[model samples]
Target: MPGIYLGAILFSLVGMMLIDLKYSLALRVAPVRTTLTVLISTSFFLAWDLVGIATGVFVKGDSPLFVGVTLAPHLPLEEVFFLLFLSYLAVVMVAVFERRAAARRRHGGGRSATHRAPLEESA
Candidate 1:
């Protein structure tokens, strides 16, 4: 009830983090890349949200989960957290696909540099 919105967001964030841990899709693949991806994506969208708020396109909605704090008019404190979750979600999505693709490639085997089977030296 009162905790529904914020609880859902926190749960999803934790779930994604756990998936990242189990697969090592983020830190193992590229820690810097994942960090930058999340940071840059979050910044871009936050800026977009700020613009929307300034332009009156965005408005804070009544929510039991929001702390009722805001950096600006119609911008709730929860929005920042939500944006971070969104960014993490995007990066995790890329990491998942990358993992699957690499697995597929490995299982499918690799071709030689010229796209042919590797030549074996004379036995």
Candidate 2:
């Protein structure tokens, strides 16, 4: 169980990548944008983690699932991978939802009751 958590995160990341590939949601649609989004988000979260660690709010808990590698005093190697996966997943999910919304709108299926013709004003 030393690296179970890392392995799980990687596995989940692979699944998400497969989904992205199938739908061309992120990389296929816009590789540069996706890369920038993931990198920026990961960097931002890593900065937040560093702040938390400095403030003693993010101590490394005892977990056998870790790979026994620390980037800094409290940051683990798995944390970087997890952050990457988190950022990638977020970008992919946003792309997926955006495409879905676009399709719905194109099909005229996105209109709400308020936007409709109000049943011809009750005849």
Candidate 3:
């Protein structure tokens, strides 16, 4: 089970890299920037997770299915992977939403500058 979980984490990381590459090529965005954003966001998420675990909001059980040390009811390593997964998911979801919104705007919902009548017409 630990092996399976580790494999899944590896697969997710690779998948995220591919997705980032596609977005970078299509949008001319920087992969480094996206990676940095993910890193920062993941850091914050890890902090939150740590706090939550400390507060007993949730409990993490022992799993031979993961790597890294487990501190009581929390596994720091698992939390890190969870953050990565969540950040990747969030970025992809946002990109999809933005694309759909842009497409909708392009399909006649967007207002043109000329479409707005002058507030004060010339005499």
lDDT winner: 2
Q: Write the per-residue lDDT of candidate 3 for residues 1-123, one digit (tens) a residue.
A: 555676787688778768756765322365566677778999898778778887988677667777755644565466677678888778766777877788878887766656665763332
The alpha-carbon lDDT assigned to residue 38 of candidate 1 equals 85
Pairs of residues at least 3 apart in sequence or in different chains that clash in candidate 3: 2-65
Output the worst ten-in-a-row residue range by lDDT, candidate 2.
114-123
Identify the runs in model 2 with alpha carbons over 4 angstroms from their true place: 111-123
User: How are the candidates ranked when ordered by TM-score, highest leading?
Assistant: 2, 1, 3
Q: What is the TM-score of each candidate against the true structure?
A: 0.77, 0.87, 0.69
Scanning candidate 1 in windows of ten residues, the lowest lDDT window is: 114-123
Candidate 1 C-alpha lDDT tens digits along 2-118: 656666788888998888888887856788888898889888988999899889899888876676677888877677778889999888888788777897798775545456534
lDDT to native, each model: 0.80, 0.92, 0.70
Best by TM-score: 2
TM-score of 1: 0.77
> Better model by lDDT, 2 or 3?
2
Sort all candidates by lDDT, best to worst: 2, 1, 3
